[model samples]
Target: MKKSILNLRLFNSQVHSRNVESKEKWLGYLFGPCGALLLNAIMATYLNVYYTDVLKLTAIWGGAFLVMFPLASKIIDAVTNVVMGYVIDRTRTKQGKARPWLLLSAPLVAISGILLFTVPNADLGVQAIWVTISYNLFYSFAFTIYNMSHNLMCPLSTRNTVQRGGLSVFNQISTIMMSGIVVALIFPMAIMPFLGVDKSKWILVMSFFSIVALPLTLLEYYFTKERVTEENVGKEEKKIPFLVQLKVVLSDKYMIIMLVYFLIYTIGTTLKNIGLVYYCNYVLGTYNDGVTQMLVSVIGGVPMGIGIFAVWPLAKKFGKKNVTVVGFLLYALGSAVCWMAPRSLPIVLAGQFIKNIGGLPCAYVFMALFADGLDHIEWKSGIRCDGMAMSLYNIIAVATVGIATAIFNALLSGAGYVAPELVDGVTVAAEQSKTVNDVITFSFVGLETITGLAMAGLLLFLTVEKTIGKKQQKIREYQKAEALARGEEWEEPEVKAAKEEEAFFVESEEIFRQELKLKCEKKGLNYDEELQKHIDKVSLKRKKEAEKKNKAKEKEELRLRRIEEKQREKSARLTPEQRGKKEEKARIRAERDEKKWQEELLKGEAYRAKIQAALAKRTK
Candidate 1:
């Protein structure tokens, strides 16, 4: 039995499972961003505050310079990002496209992140020059590479929607809970109080994160697999020109929707993160030294953490877009609650908790939805858009930080916001005027309310999921045709996935048997008896897990049932003519969806033919 189990394990290990979910992959995804994002969260949450208060940049450069600097700097990144995306798409190496870039970015991010924080104590002109160069170095160059490559990993790693969703969950958790929560709660609560206005201590703190980032990034690169990227290996297909590919990606309506969605969400969150310090210092009645901000972070972070687990199941049940819409509504509702009493800590915390809960579904599943849009574009265009789509995605992710910061600084400076001053011997926060306080409050909560409502409405037009589902088989056929034209054989993704799943069961059985055999040997017991006991234990555990899942499913069903009952009651109140018109509208909508699907299918066939003919002519 032991020999057979060993043989089975070896066989399973030899059969590579592309896009199959595994513990190592999930861990890599989770740990990859921990170091970098932790540093970034710290910067996003505090760097602006540090510049305004500790460095006293406003004293040197005019107040308008603060607003113009970040916005102007992002213009460089915006252009750089597009060029980098084009370069990444054409780049081929033994380490794969994105991983090689990920590796190169590690040292760059580490060095630049530290330098950005370590602004030298020199002449005002020197300090300003140092800040500009370091800021651009860290954000425009290093962070862009890291962010783009890390995001590209997800779509390239898998085409399987379920596995993609799982990876996305881990990615979001790492960004939100691991990096975000720690920075939000711990940094402000513990570190900020200690650092005070000490620039040397700030450099020390930033350097620690810079040191941590290197190893974590290497681990992520080592463990991540770009399965979809591997699909193109040894195939000599026609390469689309950079400008043309850019046009293709930009013109995809789904990509546009995702870009807009991402921009609004990032801007809203950035505003909150940058404004929270000011809000706590001024609007909350006193500079309680980040204790109030820490409390607020914890209050909000806890619910967001819980909502992470629920996002996947809820998205699976109700669709990603539906879950996201509900989240936006909740966000708006929570913000409205906060608006009722902006100065009250308890009310603010409660509203923050509610708003954070609303943020979870979108935060967790946006990448997955964006990946689906990428797939849809591929289905239509017969090429992948990993680099192009993700570059734009990173642009929004990074640029919004600048946009938010600039907006906050502009408002604060305009309202005669007072920075901390050295009183007697120690630095103390200055009391702000009422207008400054109001601006802080608006940045903290009001921005989110408007963006949330706008996003909820805009997301209604994102219907790529429905189209992608209909075109899945056609996509596989196009891929096969393209590969055939290149004189290579192609295997269906579903077929490969099914084989891997069978190997998974074999591996599982082997492990269970090996463990049982070891236990029997140790105890001087019968292997047969131990095996039977182990099986029974495993069965009991499975039963309990199933019961838990069933209960959750029933609760979801009950909620849906309530919604349906409300709709029925509303329908009963309508006149017969109104009911008939509603039915006609539903019919028209269904017909329109069907018409669009058929049109897309026809277009896909034409594009596939062109690609195949072009490949054939080139081969000849």
Candidate 2:
């Protein structure tokens, strides 16, 4: 049969390398976050500007709602992030724990994202209500589901540190490319120029992303596998209670450091995102043309693109901790450089470039480090806190989005920031007060400096890489003992793969045969006899093929052939009537076997049963 152009099987195949995972899987990992984050990118980069300048929401009560709502959403996020993680940990689905949620959350993520821009045309009170409802729906609920599950995929994908590192890189690249480069860079230059204060254009731009999100998430769900989660299936203690997982996570010192490092770094990035446009509008004097902002973004983005190939290698060689520390310090250095010449576009661009280069390790390798922390927890406590850890990781991550937004809004509002206005049919951005420009500069450049230094200090205590090897070894041994206690054979993944390759009757094949036996019994047929006959037939075919391939061998092979000839001569000594009866019995048996085989093939019952059984296991 010809394969279809859009064959999903190709995407589902497992491909492995010494360091990274399958090509298809990493691609899925790369794009899956892109799906969930596309709209998030818009919100992070443009929503504040939109709320203030376009919707003129800041005009109402000094933009108090803008500042207050995101802060309120963070409170909700604190609860939802934990609950979502706990739910994911307990979820039992055929697609694995995280992947199912990836699929389930896609539509919710899409719909909620579109609704965020669709503020109703009503009074200010009604608009506030719409914005609040839509904001919570996206951040507190829908995005929480997608983001937590997406973040959890790294730890649950594999136990191999190198592969996990590679996945982390892919995950970060997806984030930077969609949220940072594309949304922050291209959208500002291309889309935002056309979307100046037009409410409908914002909806149209968001809608395009909404349409693409569902398929991208589905791609992510299909291509990625949860090998680590699958390993826990049918275990004596399959489900670790949420409290137990939380306790395990909290008890680990490394885990706490990683979480803090992640939180501080995320806050810095969110602040930068929130303040970019304000910086462009007021400081660079490029509100109408986003060229200067785009140029600066592009300059910074170059290092990130290069970091994809460089970060893992550098981390592997220099130790993830040391490399990350250096990166964060460089981040601080870059921020200082920008602060020194806040009014110079060239200086700011240079500083941003330097800062992004410094940002590489944390941007790309944080998850690998976090996964190491999870391994440490598993080693120390014999419980994997993937769900709880990711919940907390995402709580810091998701909450920071709202926290930074609120902070930026409050700061701008307090600084007496001016919104653009319609003049002679063209919407023009208003000149901001000096206080507002200073506030924007600090948010964009100064906050990162403080956060970067803090993160670098926090990373000093993260010495996980030094002991990760020994810890992982102990974890394997612990798992082996647990498996043995449950009467299950424990084998390394490589060893198991080798055995599966060599075996004719694999576990799944035997299970299928058992079903065939039941089917035979239901028809009042002798299953044992049928099974034995099938085995004999397979053995005979294999023997014939082996002999045919070995026919050219010398000396002893000729001697055996003469002996076989002598056996035929001995049989020839029998009487004609005895030979006739023997031949007749052989002919009858061959005819009976052939008839049953043909009947089985013609009915297609055996293969149909086998396929159904396989499908049942896959979906179960």
Candidate 3:
């Protein structure tokens, strides 16, 4: 009796420890980006306004600065993204690849963000130079580092679907609260009033937010642990090269679907947010010291608040893809309503509320889908390149900000928007023509509606959710095999149970099929004929899919081989020393390729065995 009581106490203690650990990990995610996200919201929504309206850059350069600079910066920023991804993939430390970057990004991001708002008091040319330099440093470099690391934490957290879904929910909640507090409340109420449209006051406000981000980053670092990353450490040489990683990612049909969806959704959202202030001031004609802007935010935010709680349940019931499709359809409908809405406050607010509610599932739950995409890549390619995957995702996110800003500025320029001028201690905006108001309305409403519809259309092609369970199961089996190869003393209980559960399900399914065949036979039916027809159909479908995959694989391999052959031939014409270096690099690559081939072969054998066993059971 005493032994039983002691065992119960021990079990309770273990469970408590696990619960605490889980809670701590989530807390890290919740608090890590609190300050950073607030800063991002401010920049996304108002930075263009600051450049055009406040800094008078539009007056100086006539939209060239706004349009050309961001486009040019994005071109350079894309290369920087690839380099950062490579660095992250090669990095190894006790703190993990993603977390260390998170820690390092804090100060760099803070300093750059502050400087972006704090342009020097100088001539127009000097200001342009300063703005260009500072924007690249912050958005392209520092924020890239921070965001890529931030995104990687989701995949690194755990492989459990439910847990990942929960993390994504927490992530959305944090984003909503931080963005809501800054954009909805603080910017309109406190900062705008105190500064009253002065560009100089932006320096002080931005500085405050930058400083606040530092401690929050520290809290994130302390609370988060990279369990998935720990398992992947010391396998650097086994990783697919950067080019190969990119190929694998691009090969996945689901990743392509997500990429297109992200581009459309991001561009649409950015345009709407940036155009909101102009829409209120120019179209609605109710610019009461930022009150209209605040109201719009509040109206949109209320539905968003409810949506953060509502989306997960709806997704669980209807499936993530279906829920997303429905959400975007409703969002597009609401945007259409807004486009046709009268300039009435209540009507506009109602449209915005509907739009927010419709967009809730996509706003939060898509991260899990991206995680599922990574799992699919690993299952197909036998490699896990989290750094590369997250980097590409971040690039899409950051690039859209630049693209949206460029497009918005170009539209404003076309619409003949004259920059506001400061006169006699007050800034006065120029009177806009009807065309200008129309452009603002179209940008803020029509563009988003179109993009939302496009996203829904693209999501129809995504089928990852259907295969995620099997992919996860295969990943677990691979991990277990790796552990056994390393001669570990104990297996993880969760992994063991999962394997057992899978076996039981497979066995039960085989038994049920056999029973159905026997019942048909007893009923004097053509059991074998019907069974053969069903099997033949399934076999044909599987065969076609396998052929397509094999073709892609062979094409990629052929491309790689051609490139290598060309390099070798070119090296033969070089100096002895140069040829030696080239040959050495070639040798190293060959060895890595051989190792990868062997690993794939082993995995193929295991898969074939599993399939063969199931087939035999069914036939018997």
Candidate 4:
């Protein structure tokens, strides 16, 4: 039986490891930022040029279309995310949980993103509408579907928190690298030329970019994994509604805060994106200055990514909230420096370098707290609720980007910059040539202001209290163990309730988990290795332990029944012989029961000791 149990676990572990490599997980990671980089750079940064210079549309019309692309998509993105979240929460597959949608959405997303830019021919209004509808459809369905299924890959379906964190890091790096290539390389090389001359060339360049980015992004959806396990899954009979899921997620303080942050930040992005082309063309007097803009893109990321590494250590030392505060301050200060720095190219570059280099680290890791916040809700509400939690994050992110563009367009039009009518492939006359620079500069300053405000909103997110330090984590881990002992899902509600009821015990558990975690970190032991060892050792004996306990309970009940029977016999006047015989039987049974209890107690203690020892080894 022991051998069979060991074999079963080994088989399960093997299956889990295999499941970890599902195509969707990696593919989604690769696609999300790469595609974001490509689409945003083109649509946000250069689409105005395409409209005014290439297609020969007026700024009001051109800007209106570009703005509406994201705005129109915002509604669709939200609707799609809610729908996908609902569908994913109810998803099941023999291939393993959420893999079906995750695997399938790649091609659809790739095609839609490409189609938005690759449309052949149509009337201007119709073309604009087509682009708007197509972009919205692609991102709303394809991106949301892919991301919802992707987040399900967390919770160690076949791995652990450490593994998930590692994956997050890997995904961040992979996506950012692609962003660098797309924004830094692609724009300087291709789009700037398209902007310089020839309306026909604009379409040709966009088509080329769409081809390059679409395939690169599709590779991500082709490579990611989706692992599966027993989870606090909503019942098949009582599926969660889309609106309810959206409502619940939005109700979360962190989710609301994230939405605010993204919304505000998107405003900054829109201004910054529009500012880029305008600054190069009108302010700096050459679209060929794309290099400086690319520099800005590269600089923005370096500091943020670097800052992220420091966040974990600082979080361990202080708290997630404190570290985030420090990050926000550093990032904001840097942005201020970059924005306010004088017109010297060297000075601006220096400011940009410092700001981005400082900001990059935090961007990579600190936002993980957003996901961690869901644990508090799970503990409080007894729902794992990944789809709702993650969807909220994505929705805010997508919506804000769209919102930013709309705000930018409104401001641009208000500033009296009409789009140039195209003459062949070039603008017939400059656009608000005299005042465009002022608009560009003022808009940039506003961008700085909005980004700063959004970062402040991110600071408020620390209030959620899901940032479990070492102490709380230990307590939760023990309850998790207890649930496992009772043959319950580790993430189930009863386990959380059981732990919540024992405050002192929980405090001690947390202290223990912390000390051990610190010790492991000091020893440089990987969390994944420790977790894998534990999962490999856990067994069906959890159910067996519950059964043995139940049997012991039954024995006590039987003993009480015998004692009551003897008392009844003794109550009869002529029943002395019967009472005496009953008493004798009762005494014999009691003695036998005592012996059995002692033996079982020893076995139980031994079993618990075995568990403790294994846990110690894993943690140590």
Candidate 5:
């Protein structure tokens, strides 16, 4: 039962490393994401401003680059993560299957984090294009490493549902925390100085601020331990060809849903966030990034922090799907309000608060929901697929992000806004102004529709509530106990089947009852006391079924009758003369039913004879 003597020991030989694992795991998740956040703060939020205002790139092209770079990570994320996931599933490593992926990739993530933000001071034309290509490549690669391992760790860290929820929630807190630092601080400090607004050394200033994200990421690797089993890990797995792997991964329904949702939500959100800078500058007539970003942070930040906690509790109570639907509907509503609101800052701020409140619960739910999929699939197939599954999901998620970025970039270009060539002033073509408005309107409406789709997906999740209920916690414990006895890691279908007979019996009872009745219902077969008892059993069951069905029919009839009565009253109002005709038809229908009952009475003898013949054949 100890960690060492088990079939696999990838990450650690120690079973009780709460002390060592605690801090190390915490930091591993932190450093990578925080670093990514700082990088994104520079890429997603500030880069457009820097290109337009400082570097004087054209709005169309600059916006295109800004949107395309981070978005390109989607393509990079899809392929890399799936490969890594399959590799992890098939890998045999002493450091643990996932740790190697993380350890090797962690530094890359940090390096890429820095690269994405570090722009060359070369002239606008060539350098802008080069920077776009380079930043996206680095980000795509870095996030692939970080997001895969980070996600894999959720399943690896603990098997308990409650513990998973707790872990997922806190990690999201890390997401929010890092997001705050990225948008609120990193953007203005790193990109603004070079625009002739401040005299600070932008490069060193950014590196210093951005480098702080690394230690936080490294912490995740240290505190977290990978829990692997022989069943879960396979050094000799049939390495799937890339095309086959891609096909199978895409076929997973849950993965596709999450993928689409991520694409829509991320793109919509990015458009809204990036557009805020433009909205404040031109529409509201202010260039103060600090005030605008601060206001956004307060509106968005506080709700996000609160949402992480709120979602778990509400999901536990009402189900994760219900809460997510409600949350998204709120998001849809907020999107509409903001789109229609006049260019007043107060109205916009109010809209943001509403949107943030609606979005908070959903942001945390999808990550934790993956735990449910891991259990349900294993239970159904007896095949361990968390690695490939996670990879497939991540790839789609990343790709959608790519498309969103691409769309936003295209929107900006079509708007015809040119990036500011001079140090302190930006030139806006009429097309640019028109495009900005269209982008805003599109974002508000488009995101709302996606939210509706998200709600529909959440409904599909409801069926699992009963079968998998309260069993996620027990399943993990059972996994370890059975593996200990069998000298393996995961449970084979035979092993899992032993624990599932209770469920099988419950499902099969009705069929068994019917078979028993068929044998008992024989005539002239020298029936004994045993036959009599069985007949009693079948009769009682028949009575119960009939009673239930009759009750349901009665209720349905009552509802229909009420509806018909209302129709009758409404029709009478339309044509007073038609009322007598309607009453005549009702009387004819009653008389027809009475004649059918008399006919049934006349046929009773024939019906009894048929029953007798059936009994004789059953006896024969």
Candidate 6:
């Protein structure tokens, strides 16, 4: 049994190493998020409705709790994100850093998700406490672990940028399909009418979703390969300090831009999602059944689903930022049209379809954008903070959802929207007025429109796409330099191949020289003189090659110097406070660089000691 287990383990290792090269591996990556996001969509879209309608939480309490609880949890979640990132970065395991977390988190997330919707029969205050505890447990802690790990899988899966883009497309398609299933089918067709908004029924539905999600997570784990992560498996010195990683990632202009764009984008999408139920119920007069919600979801989801395929190719052609900007503009226009349209179902559906069409680029391509930003961070800082980058990405996404929920709740409460009471397992909804309907409309259309436009404006500053090739080259150079500095045997493929070819030529040349020497001796000629001539020729050729290399190095250094000089000149033009900020940023970067240098130095010493010990052992 022991031998069999060992053999199985070795077989798994062999399969994992080859997974990245397998074209079919994308099936695993594509389906991994399906089950997870199905549950996620339900929670993000319907939890508020459940709280207000089924649990009978007052609008004021619901709004305040949703806002304040998540806001308070943000501090903890932020710390958790960063710490989890560092933990993943430092983790050394056969399963890889990010994948192990996915396995651990799958069951935890499932259990916590069920608990989040499964509050006991209690008084209002008691239920509020339960909701807070359960929500913080699941979303702030358990889900963060899962989400951060899941997102970091992209960069770790493969280093090929084109493959990364393909993965992003698959991810978006999965997410859209999941959203459609939850919003268009499950919530409306199964849960709403059949389950009748009962708390117990909601719990059952959540439990069912959670159970289905578990196996998918395992499948995802089985299918994905952490190729990039495998390369850094045993390199402890490669792990940067959390503070330094945070500083370097945050200091990146493109990172900040992507974060802001995502924040605004999340706020807009969250508000629209939260408001959709209310809009259908109050504004469209479909409170009795979830037909309008289903209709809107199906209408929006179809175009968005179809549109995702176009996004990858368009992103490749026009760049992710440009495509996203265009998408946002179209989305804003669609929202404006929705705001103006009458309460006709077809018109509303039409607007929704258009809006979803416009949202495709941002929805489908932002992960790729974030991945690009991570590369930029790695290129600029000489470190890959996939953990830190994805952690902050998760935080921004979660925080924006909270903020959007808070705003939605506040608006609902201010508009005099009332929570329904559960009597004998039936929810008695309040009679909503025009003010409530108007608030829902504005929240769904007006708010989304404004935020979408703001996202477009902010995204115009993004210029990362143009210089990605150069940045990637710099990252390769940095990696090679770091490897050499630590006395490790690492080289770029081209460089290693070139060196091997040169060595082969030198060996052949020496063989030829020996043959020539024998001939010279046989002919009673000056053998030493012929050898000297051959040595001079080879030496002169090496001199020319060395000079060429030196010239290339000098040119690169001059280019970098000019860029830095221009930056310094730009800094000189800044105001006093801005200049102070710039100086502080420079100090942090210097500190990070110094720490990196010390790590390399220590690694070099350790490597030398290792070599010396090995030599001593061999001699003995």
Q: How close to the true structure is residue 25 of candidate 1, measured as C-alpha lDDT?
A: 54
lDDT tens digits, residue span 377-421, model 3: 777666677888777877888788788889889888978988766
Candidate 2 on 1-620: residue-level lDDT in tens?
A: 11242233333323232223455445677876687777777777887877888788986776788888888888898899899888877776545667667767889998988898999788988988898888889888988888888887888777888778888888888888886677867787888888888888888888888878888887777667676765665564545656667866776678888887878888888898888888877897668586877877887678888888898989987999999999989999999899889888888888988998998998889888888888776666666667788889888987888888888888888888888886765778778888999999998899899998999899999887776776677667767876788788898755653453346246435876798799898998888888887778878976985585577355659977998999799779989998889889989998986686556334433433443355446556
For TM-score, candidate 1 versus 2, the one ahead is 1
Candidate 5 stretches greater than 4 Å from native: 1-32, 57-77, 121-129, 185-202, 228-251, 424-435, 444-466, 469-620
Whichever of 2 and 6 has more TM-score, that candidate is 2
Lowest-lDDT window of 10 residues in candidate 5? 13-22
Give the root-mean-square deviation of each candidate in angstroms.
7.0, 20.3, 20.9, 20.5, 19.7, 15.7
RMSD of 3: 20.9
How displaced is residue 427 in candidate 6, in Å? 4.4
A best-first ranking of the candidates according to their TM-score comes to 1, 2, 3, 6, 5, 4
- lDDT at residue 528 of model 2 (Cα atoms): 82
lDDT digits (tens) for residues 147-221 of candidate 6: 888887777766567777777777777788788867676687557776666667778878999888888887776
Residue 57 shift from truth in candidate 2, angstroms = 1.3
Off by over 4 Å in 6: 1-26, 59-67, 421-428, 491-620
Model 4 lDDT per residue over 1-620, tens place = 12244233221211222323334345545354365446545665666556545554443364666566668779889877766766666654433345556556656655665666554576776766676667676668776676666555443242234345445555565545655666556676566754564645665666565555555544543454344233322323234455545555665566567556656655665677667666655554445555666655665456544554664555545655565566555556655665674344555556555555534434555445544555544433334467766666667766776776566665666566755445655544464645555667656543564466467556664554332333235335645675677676655443432343355345545675677678779999986677556445444544665587799779979988997898666567547787788779989998986686566446534544654454456555
- Give the count of colliding residue pairs in each prediction: 0, 0, 0, 27, 26, 0
Q: What C-alpha root-mean-square deviation, in Å, does candidate 1 show against the real structure?
A: 7.0
Which candidate wins on TM-score?
1
Identify the runs in model 2 with alpha carbons over 4 angstroms from their true place. 1-21, 496-620
Candidate number achieving the greatest lDDT relative to the actual structure? 1
Clashing pairs in 3: none
